[model samples]
Target: MSTAWQDLTGRARLRDAAIEAFAAQGFEESLRSIAARAQVTAGLVRHHFGSKDALRAECDATVLERYRQLKEESLQADPHQLFTHLPASAQGGVLLLYILRSAREGSAAGRKFTEQLIDEALILLNQSVSRGLIVPSRDEPARARLLILQSLGALVLHFALNPPQDPEDFAAVMQDYYSRVALPTLEIYSEGLFTDSAYLNEYLLATAADVPPATDAGITESR
Candidate 1:
């Protein structure tokens, strides 16, 4: 292969390896192990990625890419039906791993990556607000951050308690909680948050696809 082809192939392999490693072992895994999995030398991994932090960032980006792609596909498919297939536990597990790893390390790379993750999450929440899928209230940004943190906390708690035997279980609980608790609370915060019934329907559909519904029927007594 040409030099350009070689570089592209190497980079692709490195990215794939990094995603697998990060998903499995998180940021604490050794660089050597990641490089080995990629069938590349550590020097090569460093050459392409610059540093361990850079590599971790790249891995985080890859994971986010998966999320973005899923969201886009779901929106395109039947925005209302898109979330039905979501894997709640796996998604939660991966995100939890990233957050915990970053907090534990407190490295510049970890902090930067965590901030980027938070920013992206806020952007998504804001997008939902703009679309009227969510209620718009004071401190929109803060609300978005709080929601993301809550979701993250739920995943962390689930992992600590369950350790995820079946990923679907995680998704089911997440979906149920969001529908009964999260979505209704947001709606109450601002009825104007949703543009129409379609938006609310889509939100429920997508969330249900992503996680399981609550046990007490679709309507929770509190909401």
Candidate 2:
């Protein structure tokens, strides 16, 4: 459990329990089960949040905010620390699993939750550019959205293919998954696949009518 879940009272305790329960068992997890996890009554849960839907929305907000905080902290640390912890923390963290469940459940709130994530990514990437940690993009919004999509899309596919026996095993499963991908991902980022940007330049020229030609450093980031 996260230290964030510790030393809680009333509504806060219920919220943390709901995050854990929903992450483990999906959104269909009963209020009674969540209440039991928090050592509270279901009626108390209803009293605080009114409905399961409201509780879920609250969980979504909490998860997103937690992610934002973690990422901001990583930005202030060694940039590579983020990727080093990505497999376990970002992939296996309860907050992330909860968001993934939201996306898989296909609820309206679920879709909105994902859109919110992308928006958050946009803000973070803009910060990165402003700090000169990363090069500015010709189309900043597109690049931000693409990075989030590629990352979360790959994670969604990973879980679908290798469904864990228990949610508690999320960290182990994701760590193993990242072990397989980490080297190649690092290599691709460190070493360009193509010898030159001829193909990209040609494509840019072809599409110049729609937008002005501008070269971006792809994924340039300061160490």
Per-model TM against the reference: 0.62, 0.83
In candidate 1, which residue ranges exceed 4 Å CA deviation? 75-84, 88-100, 103-107, 164-223
Q: Name every residue pair that clashes in candidate 1.
A: 83-209, 84-209, 88-171, 134-193, 135-193, 171-211, 171-212, 172-212
Kindly provide the TM-score of model 1 when superposed on the true structure, using C-alpha atoms: 0.62
Q: In model 1, how large is the Cα lDDT of residue 83?
A: 45
Pairs with backbone N, CA or C atoms under 3 Å apart (clashes), candidate 2: none
Model 2 agreement with the true structure over 59-165: per-residue lDDT tens digits: 88988999898778877887577677767763345765776687677779978988898999999989988997766777877877887778777768877987767
- Estimate, for each residue in 1-223, the C-alpha lDDT of model 1 and write its tens digit: 4598889889889977776566556667788998998887989898888988777667777766665555446444663454454435456444445555554456786666656667776777667667756544344556667766665566456556645354324355445444545465546565746455676456666876653353333333223
Residue 212 CA displacement from its true place in model 1, Å: 35
Output the TM-score of candidate 2: 0.83
Each prediction's total of clashing residue pairs, residues at least 3 apart in sequence or on different chains, is 8, 0
Candidate 2 Cα errors over 4 Å, as ranges? 1-8, 79-92, 215-223
